[model samples]
Target: MKDDTKIVHVGRANAKRHNVVNTPVYRASTIVFEDTQQMREAMDGAVGDRKKVMFYGRKGSPTSWTLEEAMTELEEGFDTVLAPSGLGAITTALMAFLRTGDHLLMVDSVYEPTRHFCNGMLAKFGIKTTYYDPNIGEGILKLITPTTRVVFVESPGSHSFEIQDIPAIADAVHSFSDQNIVIIADNTWGTPIFHKPLKLGADISINACTKYIVGHSDVMLGSITAAKEHFPVLYDGRQQLGVAVSPDDAYLATRGLRTLGVRLNQHQENTMKVATWFSERPEVEKVMYPALPSDPNHRLWKRDFSGATGLFGIVFKQTSREAVSAMLNSVSCFSLGYSWGGYESLICPSVVSHIRTASTWRYAEPGIRLHIGLEDPEDLIADLEIALKSFNTFL
Candidate 1:
């Protein structure tokens, strides 16, 4: 089925309660069984079929399962597990395969918090991480050591916006490794609607459902979808970590998911209009969006992705911090804050040069990340024009 059709129908078949179109929230903690035999069967089912049978509240309820089912269908994976937030999903997936003394190959452009987990928690656990260039492609084989258990890739890396060649990296890891080495891709930016990591050879695919999947800023949730061979371990690890999402959040995420296709379409349309406008501005050094034909990574993005999201970065020309602040502060429509993939537009300064270790950030000028949102493109442009005028005045 097409993504739009699947989005509306995937999890709704058995989700309805009393003929309701949407799944009712099942607030559960302790599930009561009819008898001791039933309880024994439930325990066995929990161990054997975690998705279908819920022995306890932490294991998951129908509400959460509906979302999981929908995500699994969207991601084209064997199954999926839920987490409290995007970072929780990443850490849970990492801990599932990693152990003490293991080496991790992390993309230099990974999300900042993921890098922190590698340097702080994973390092504390005695695991070694080697950050590699995002554009390394098949050359990633050089970084794989005998101890390397996982290679993490985030295409269009956080803030930097470099699209990693996922297929090349995954092929390299599988070809070079004698032992089982998993390739995990963060699909938050290139959501299942745009790109399917599993189809591109990744062993595991992760999505910050808190973003596009939720389609709003109201709920925080994440999903980890695994290949068949890796599902058992991923599921066991999530269960061991006691990682559980609130059913309320799950329900809202699912509700938001229904409009994901339409919402993202509008987001892409609005973003293109805004990004093109920025490209024409003298104060803008570059509009870092892969969807643009002029972008360095556009060829790869075009090859692998069906569409682009609302998020993109804008690099400013040589400018003062005060001028940038003036622009950010003067914006009436775009909120100066963190987080993206909401109905409302947002803008935030992104400085990644200091945080990177594997590759150098050559641009001396700072950049602003923008989430174009669902607002009318003309209104958003008018707002940005005013902000840019404010920026020029300060300059």
Candidate 2:
């Protein structure tokens, strides 16, 4: 069956419980054992498999497994592990595969927290991380060391929006050695709805479900989807780490996923309109949305992805931080804040100079990330126009 039809039916099957379609949120840690053998089986990984139809809750309840199964099927391979946050999805996936003295290759335009995880956590564990240009492609072969175990990526990276040549890099990584090098992609921005990194030779796909997967800002959760070849490593990591999210949080995430498809389509549409408007504005320096024809990565995006989301940024040519602040603050319709992908529009200055390595993020002007939410496009455009006017006036 297709993913769209599967999304509605995959998790909700049992007509036995008041004919309820959604899985009941089973909020319990202790399970009443029927017998010693059953208890023993519960302790084992056998009960945790969704195919088994019986779970003891630490391994994940039916409620959580339903969502995990839904996500795993969406990416077209293997099983999945759930994490408390998006970073959990990334870090746990790394912990699942990498060991001491393993050399890791990461895309230069990676999320900042991921870079911190590489520098601070992995460094202390004797793992060496190497960063390569986002456009490196097959040239990445030269950087791969004998000890290279993982190639971590975040395509159309959160800050600069550089789309890495994932298939080329993955092919290059596998050609050199049969030493089980794992490829990981942070699919938070992709949300599995648009881009399936696993199709491009990625062993693991990580999504911050707090983004489009949840389709709302309320839930904070992360998930890791793995190919069958890599599922055992993730399962082993979960068993060893004893990581699990609360049932309440899992319930919210699952609920949010129901409308993800429609929500994402709207986000893509609204963002395109806003980006087009901003592109024609004199005060705007450049729009960094993949959907924009002017974006450098637009052609690559066209070749790969079928859809775009709400997350995009605009760089304004100016020296005035205060002017930027005024523009952000003066907005009446849109709220100034962080962490988007909610029902409401949000705006904030995202410019940072803390970049240490890789390409300098020096924009032609200071930049602000815009999350086009479920607002009337004209209202949002008017709000932004007035905000730009405020910057004009305040300056």
- Could you say which candidate leads in lDDT? 1
Highest TM-score among the candidates is held by which one? 1
Off by over 4 Å in 2: 14-16, 45-55
Task: Give the 10-residue window scoring lowest on summed lDDT in candidate 2.
Answer: 45-54
Clashing pairs in model 1? none
Could you tally the backbone clashes for each prediction?
0, 0
Q: Write the per-residue lDDT of candidate 1 for residues 1-395, one digit (tens) a residue.
A: 99999999998876556898888898989999999999998899888546477688899888998999999999999899999999999999999999999999999999999999999999999999999999999999888889999999998886988998988888888996577999999999988999999999999999999999998799999999999999999999998999998999999999999999999999999999999999999888888999999899999999999999999998877767788898899998899878998899999988889888989987755678899898899999999999889888887
Clashes of 2: 0
lDDT of each: 0.91, 0.82
lDDT per residue as tens, model 2, 153-268: 89888867778788888899889767789999988776777888999888899989887777767888999999987897888887678788877787788888888878888989
